[model samples]
Target: MAGCFDVMQHNASFDWDTRRNTYSAIFAGFLFFFAWWLVIDTAVVFTPTGDWNNWYFALAVSCSLSMFMVNSVSNRALEGLYSEEGVLGVKGTRIWLMFGFIGSFACIIAGIWIMFGDYVLQKNDNPKWPGVAIFLHTLLTFIASLTYKFGRSEELWD
Candidate 1:
């Protein structure tokens, strides 16, 4: 048992320098899990009896995941921005970065709009848990991406 535990610990160990990456990944995982939970809860537990549309919840999940992917890809591209020898010119890199940021921002805005227009404004007396969950998921995705980006830095913020 001790031997097995030691092996497991060794495999799970992460370098201190990459702790931020681990944390951001964990946060992303939690966000995805919560999003899934929200969807399932809405479907199984809180079956909408009114004229509620399911598209809003779906859109929220899609937007959150899409934002995360775009931000990650753009961040990887931006890493090559300062490289003078790269095939992608600095101008191209900047363009990609700008597009990625815009897409991410758009996703957040869309999530908010869905939450407000679908759940908040509805005339139902049902709990607004789904909308709240989606909004939190979108916000957490944004935060996780920012954490991944800034966590790469080793400098102390003075």
Candidate 2:
């Protein structure tokens, strides 16, 4: 039953710092902010070439929604199957979180595809930074999300 919940438990012997939770949260927050910063820079540095250009900014929106999906579930929801607290049972919660992870990963892959296919592969005068920036945004967000989810001290909150 522990499966995914294994990391939720505290391990004092492996701890590098007494403030592990605080540090993990700070790192996660920085990553999240940096992710948005990169995407916003993409939005600012590049003007819309046309309605099609709007897809660049749309990636940010999609990443944000997917981030919400990943972070929306509580750790406890997955820890207890028989508990009456969550409306969604353990299986449902697991599925919801799974979809979230999938969405986030998909966003990053799409960003990579756009970077190479649209900018790198093409011989247009357009700079490659925009594509790279978008990819960074999605990748950073995905890393930040997983870090926030798994890096925190679950027992501290309990």
Best by lDDT: 2
Q: What is the per-residue lDDT of model 1 for residues 29-136, given as tens digits with 9 covering 90 to 100?
A: 676666567656665555556434666666666655555555544444555534453665656766755665676677778778767876798886766766676676
Q: How well does candidate 1 match the true structure, expressed as C-alpha RMSD? A: 6.4
**Backbone clash count, each prediction separately:** 0, 0
Give Cα-based local distance difference scores for all models: 0.62, 0.79
Worst 10 residues of 1 by lDDT: 149-158
Per-residue lDDT over 51-109 for candidate 2, one digit per residue giving the tens place of the 0 to 100 score: 13656777777877788898888787877734485677888888999999888988988
The clash tally of candidate 2 reads 0
| Per-prediction TM-score to the true structure, in the order listed | 0.62, 0.80
**Which segments of candidate 2 are over 4 A away from where they belong?**
1-18, 48-52
lDDT of 2: 0.79
| Alpha carbon lDDT at 3, candidate 2 | 83
Lowest-scoring 10 consecutive residues by lDDT in candidate 2? Answer: 45-54
